[model samples]
Target chain A: MIEKIDGFAYILGDDINTDDIVPSHTLTMRDVDEMAKCTLEFIDPTFAKNSAQGNIIIAGDNFGTGSSREEAVYVFKVLGIKAIIAKSFARIYFRNLINLGIPGIIVSWNESIFSKGDNLEISLNEGVITNKTKGVKIEFEKLPNFLTKILEEGGILNQLKKTLKG
Target chain B: MGYTIAEKILINHSNLKSISPGQFIDCNIDLIMVHEQLGGRIHKEYEKLEIDYVWDPNKIFFILDHWVPAPTISAAQMHQDCRKFAEKYKFIHNFGYQLDKGICHQVLPEMGFSRPGMLIVGSDSHTTTYGAFNCLATGIGATDVSVVFATGKLWFRVPESFQIIMSGKFNKGVMSKDFILTLIGNISTKGAIYKSLEFHGQGAKNLSIDGRMTISNMVVEAGAKFGIFQPDNKLETWLVNRTKEPYKLVTPDNDANYENTLEYNLSEITPVVAKPSNPGNIAGIEEVEGIEIDQAFLGSCTNGRMEDLRIAAKILKGNNIDPNTRLIIIPASKEIYMEALREGLMEIFLSAGAVVGNCTCGPCIGGHLGVLGSEEVCISSTNRNFKGRMGDPTSEVYLASPAVVAASALKGRIADPREVL
Candidate 1:
């Protein structure tokens, strides 16, 4: 299966910590819509309002560092983030995203080539990323079979659900 | 090729006879620690599983410390949900909504749940703190933990191991916190992402259990998956009375394969602080000295043990906190709180104009207690210094050892601990 994800890029800088993604104070709120409003509120007050559905997050190193608050990733899920491409990611954050069936990609950062609002096309099977706006193609290491299996199955919960049914 | 301690522990817990980094393997979890997230963030995913009965009720623990005393009505409701869940699942180790129990990381070990050669997972990031006992412990998200609750098993992509060999003794006022802060500065926060850090050498072996816990607790700051120590007499002796569970000490083979090795002589390290906005933004005492602070915090899962309290008391006994600065002290667990009270450390703190609060993660996560105001600067002994971690995003935090936090509170600025000690 040639799984592909394409979306407009939303650029972010280095060390976009979990606190910046989903501030601790907002964790008490039960509504996903209310929590999504505060996504990246600390780093950019307009992020939640401006971000469009199906937008991909392109970031610098150490994205989603600090705190194991899955709400940080949950906000992105709620914001309709299609995929996350970064130079690196914190271990727990990356794991959380993958467990939730979100595509978290790590690439060697090229600051000059990718710009905000650039159209991006990611091929999960081919391990290639195409910058549609700039006409540049970059390759990345594909996720391992087990991880892709989890993603294909619509996250660990669904996988577990299937196993339980079996 | 020999396996690292992390590999050995993973292999011990799993059915695999041989394991290496990046290979996904399912391992039986020895312990699962839960906090408020179990009722809140984790509950949503847990319900998806639709499994009413846990795999093993005895294997799980619930400690409500993050929002202890429930500052908000919503938080109080979450506490109610947690109590109902515990009752439904028959979790025997549930600590309930007790105000005295304290942080899960500290309280779990004190209750004899953590042991060497165990695979422990918690919903909180600082769950790595249990690695001080040589356990292959790491943190995971709510969805992952939800699955563990039903199966008593979790998967791991065995992390590549890094060797941190420590030698020599720490200088006065320079403690494990200084060593870890300096190391995090040296190896940027992203340096150890997806890697396991195994502390070794004479200096690591010589550290008290409290000091070792402090080191393991902050490994998450450097993005390390686990910060395990080499088990030795200190841990073995300490565990003698804490647990009756017999366990073998897992150690790396003499020729264990390491992704990288770094050596440090503790004597050469001095008191350091992580400047505002990041735990990796390290600055020595001289570099950040005399920077005025509005508040000083002396507690967290990172440095809230009895040893940390004693270090603060030594400097605060005869001195009053600066009138302009507010000081807050919280012990990590009820055991540590009782110990501090018995040792008269609580008196020194109270007489020094410091507010001694019950054990809660308040203020650390900006949840409650003594939150900071905008533009305020605080010197804290807590682990993280991320923006708005203690309060408003505009407020700044300087991370230091207990000695530095105590001395800074007295001077109303970032002060050198050596001067007071």
Candidate 2:
């Protein structure tokens, strides 16, 4: 698992839902790459391209609050979004991110102290996220060992694969 | 302190004799269902696991809903993939569109596959509907579902229980949908995040099975993990005719600890509606009355049942839908459709100028049957009114009960059901 990491940051509003993550209108799609390009297009238009370099995303409460579409996580992973730090998240969306081995950290941050162009560092070991631009440190509940192990093995599938082999 | 209904159910489902909220535990799933759209994602994840076979295929339900009868070529292919997976695994619980089970939420309970004192999960968000039967059902993501398919187990964080001690009697025209709408409006969509709403008191007992299902199914919209009612005679009768398996009913202890309690009186609630773009954007019927509408939909897992159809039919039997507006009625399942047919509800709808469709979650997800165009507006019985929920982003959807949908259809705009009845 990632003990610490730093990446560029992006910000979003409260109640950002799966529909906003990926609209149901065109969800007949299958390819992750194509779908990744279409994500948040209604809101950020260029989010897909900007996310390619593994940018970090910061958002307000209830992120991924609508729908149980796992594609929400798949698209984020494919687009190279490294991690998400939010106030609170819908349970299914948070689980989807963890199951896919992507980081979804719930933490408290002052949006005024940070901007989209800023940088943030997440330390999974210390259970804290530091806004490198403004040097703001926020504490969070570190994930349990079992969940951390799933992320360490690059998702539950890989872990399951190892279990099967053993 | 004693255990709440959710805690009791979780304890029973888990190997543990007792459990507390906030503890993460691995528990076996009593029923795990996948609609075609979610099944597509689950199948992909299952293949990624490289598992040769499902852990327990019989326990899984391969439901051919969401895009029933294949809306397009690609959708047809998705169903085809699910069918092949079910056949290859010899999973006998598969319910194809042709089987007429309707939506999985409606069919699963009607067929007695969803029993009380069990833990159920599904890839679709509305799977919380099974909580109506006193089962601990919740929506799960593709990853969790894939894990369940591989091991028949998934990890869960036990949720705190929030009590709703409901009382009073509803007005004649008021239904359970009205009560839930009023509650959602008061609590906001995310008010009950990650908590289970355990309903009790006279109001909960007065509701029928259908009413209970409507409330539980929409808990996800309120950001609640579960909306449950203690198993009563209404539920007992519903299960007695359907279930062959012996079952046990669990209820909250008298001194059960709850995170919070909110009391509601049935008489205080009015016919309500969730306006365009958000389920939480709610208002009384009078506030939205006379808003122009192009369509009125009466279906989806939330309200697409025989009782829902009967409610709509009763108001429209001697009336006609507005010529400028279109009305579409869908029974939730094949069995529901048959029951409505036997009851002449279908005749009432057809005679009232509404198009009665088969049992499918078509227009609600913007799948098919009656999708809206730009600038169009609809009053629908289904849950959720997010942007482009039924069609173009420019289109608008107002969520209400089946009675509201029927009343609005007759007036070509949003109308209070009480006025019509």
Candidate 3:
């Protein structure tokens, strides 16, 4: 019963690692709201400042690479990021994001298809994103069947909790 | 078919009768370690299962190293959670802020916890450093760590072995860090994914134990499972002096089969540095000479050994640091710190205007101290020089050996160590 998300895109270049996603220094703050304000503070000082809640982010290959830090994923979730579309992802980062219930899609389209401020609509169930402003549509690899359940339950820990409770 | 030391160990400890290269197997774990930074979440996950006791407390070790002497209230809370878990579960191997407590990787081997041919897993990436003792070690995620904690078995694919042979003496100013950086350049970052790297040759034998640790520590940079050199008399002598535990000497058989073989002439390797954004982007020091540096740091599990300090001392003796630069030195372990103090290495560093700190993984992880400012440049002896790795995302980090970093600290620009030494 989840609604589809529509938003302007924030396009980033390649190799966005965990450090840029969430600086280690700000990790001292346990509050999700405070931490999200500083997310991607290193890469774009105005990222949190300029971003509206529930905005979509699209990036080139090898996004969210480096360190298994979970805070990097949590910060994005707290900031209300609708979905992340990347050409590819580092194995660990991809797993981490999926485990945290953050919608991360892997699209094979050329990065040139999307640009900043393009109005994009993402359908989690359909696994397709349409750049409405550019009249472009891109398909992504569907999440594995088991991972869909994890996302539905709001992450691995929550899924585990449900299983234990039952 | 003869077997390499790694193959022999995997077969011996493995539940499977025979595991060929590229085959997956579920193996028994001898030790699983965690630090405070990641332990809280892992412990929370374990609590959800409502397990009464860990699978085996003796096989598990937790140390409060990162953010130890807790840098913040939240870090202190993380430590408190770790303490509660340790106390409740009777985790016998837990070490707090005692004299023996230091970096987990440094202390694990020192306390006779790791033996040759054993499999070790930890929550930190640099756990692969235990491979210096001929152990199969790698890092895992918090969930994987919790799973290993609940069950002393983890699944892994038996990786194909890469035979790397080296010969000839290392050129002056080129240390083990430079040698490893050159190897990573040749292999690229993902070149050795899911493979075992076995170092063998006259060149490897010539390296000191500390230098061997430096090389083995960064195997993760090349995406290798582990890096191991056969244990020899030097290792035997060092281990005997350090611990009373008996360890079996192991080596690869003469006819052992390898998936690939790579040969390097040590004399041909120059001072190498990994450029920003990727550890695989390597270049010679000469290629990037005169690149200004705001800081030069000599520490990390990779280059913070005693031998690394002695070499830096030899180069920095009777010299002052560049007026524009800040150089920080951190010993790898408390034992190395005590030894360096006895040998007056500290005075040599302090007299040269360098700041020497405790034996912790500081600044190397960008958690504390020496965080670079925007547009700042740093030459470091630590592994992994990815962009924003040191502090500022815009700051540039150049990876080099202790010799290169020490020399650059004096010159205020990236310079070859041989020129100053």
Candidate 4:
């Protein structure tokens, strides 16, 4: 439901799969904080140790492939990831982000534009991603108006609640 | 313009009749399936809403799978929660632990609730497996599942179609699993990303309903929204005795527009494996043949069917399992387990010194049973060879068809099934 957020950027590479997002063994705890400790530990052993709250993640194409585990998106939500901008997203990952009310923006791949800890800004309504550090901008294709309404409601749960009451 | 199978089904179910790829529309859901793991989460949300019964209990089904019989205290609690919810709602249910007939994907069809030209959604990615029967199925998260429960509605952005044309025929000991794995190898993991894969061509038509399932189950590994085939006599025969529910059969028009059309000749299909850490990281069996493994797993939503068990049994008969390897056979559902037992496939597995696990996902999700220890190497029929997929991240997972898995178990190496078959 909350929109127009700005944060520093965190960059990860292509096909950073579900296992890397949260290992299967760590799923015992649903507490966001407890589960967030293992975030991306499968691939980057140092990620959990280095996560910064309010940082946005910019990923390469096919981000969040493998396994339909939502922990991948859950940890980021807990960590307060401002938004995610990717060249492309695996279908279920994109769906999970929408259901969770996370801003998932798709942009064409540009290696020269971003570096870890860069200044990033997204205009959700306009579908534009700007890298302030490099002074570059990319236009993203707009999502359907229906999904935009859900995201504006801060995820599907709130949307469902409203629908049920009505 | 003509429409693909997925588009046709989505259009029919949506509030509107005409739609295009990338356009979002709300549609009525035909079925909602969930397991204990997800059902527990949905229960919490359902309570939070304070609803009066469900919108339609008959449209929903619960399965006590994913750590069947309760592998841990928490798992037991989750299963109990699912059971309690099912009891309160009196929804259609299948508990593998009690009746030995669960595994939502396989059981739904085996029991015949799913049908051609339907819009199905589940909380598990392998829900796409239902597409083999020509239905449009996809996976979503717990929150989405909860929404569907509150209202029998969900929204989808129609996906563009990626048509895969499979022609020719299977080689000796080669099956749909092998060709599909090979196709994944060539396509890479993200090749299909958000698109739907509509399978066609003579090669696909020649595959048994079981074999088509093997192909559809892993389409998610290639980043596909769904994988499906045209309805055939094979599926009709399987369904004739199971249900009399009136349903429609949908086929894409010949002039259907495709984002891209990929053609493959199945006669050239080779035995392959998705090396550890990636399902798309494939290599020919000859390249990795002599590599030894610590375990061999033959089951998952991807393979654990009667045909897969029969394939493994056909290769394992009389030949003992290599003492160096641990082979675990987990049938997909209770019906498959019972069918295997009736066919005497269980005796062969026992004689081969394989551990016959229950009708559950078992170690595929690393929930329990057959978990690989650190540094262990495993050849499996399960989908997704992601890092630590079967157990330890340091351990290696090789994705193969049941034939290769069975043969490798007998040889203690990644040998092709043809060597033994």
Q: Which lDDT tens digits does candidate 4 get at residues A1-166?
A: 3466678878888888888798877765646587887888876776666667327888998988876767788788877776888888888888889888888888776668878877878888888778898898878887777778878987888877776788
| Candidate 2 per-residue lDDT over residues B39-146, each given as its tens digit | 457777778877688888779877887887777987877788778777777787877646466888998998898888988999889999998998889998888888
Clashing pairs in 4: A1-A152, A1-A154, B100-B334
- For every prediction, compared with the true complex, DockQ reads 0.82, 0.68, 0.24, 0.64
lDDT of 3 by residue, B1-421 (tens): 8887678778877866666886656688888988874444577667876768788988888887766567678877777877888888888887854634567888777777767778888877678788788777877667667667767776666778899998887888888888888888898766676678999999888888888888888887776777888887777777776677666777888999899899988888889898886777899888998999999999878888788999899989999999999999988778888888999999999999999877677687676767888989999998867667778778889989999999999999998899988
Residue B255 error, candidate 3, Å: 6.3
After superposition, the stretches of candidate 4 with alpha carbons farther than 4 Å from their true spots are A1-3, B94-99
DockQ of 1: 0.82
For all candidates in order, the CA lDDT equals 0.91, 0.85, 0.79, 0.84
What is the full ranking by lDDT, best candidate first?
1, 2, 4, 3
* lDDT tens digits, residue span B241-296, model 1: 89998988988899999999999999999999999889999999999999999999
TM-score of candidate 1 versus the correct structure, residues matched by position: 0.98
- Which segments of model 1 are wrong by more than 4 Å? none
Error (Å) of candidate 3 at residue A132 is 9.7
lDDT of 4 by residue, B102-186 (tens): 5778988887877999899888888899999889988877777877887889878789899999899988888788888888888
Best by TM-score: 1
Of the native A-B interface contacts, what share survives in model 3? 0.15
**Model 3 stretches astray by more than 4 angstroms:** A1-12, A45-64, A76-109, A112-166, B1-13, B20-24, B243-259
Q: Looking at model 3, give its docking quality level.
A: acceptable
- Chain B TM-score, structure 2: 0.98
Greater-TM-score candidate between 1 and 4: 1
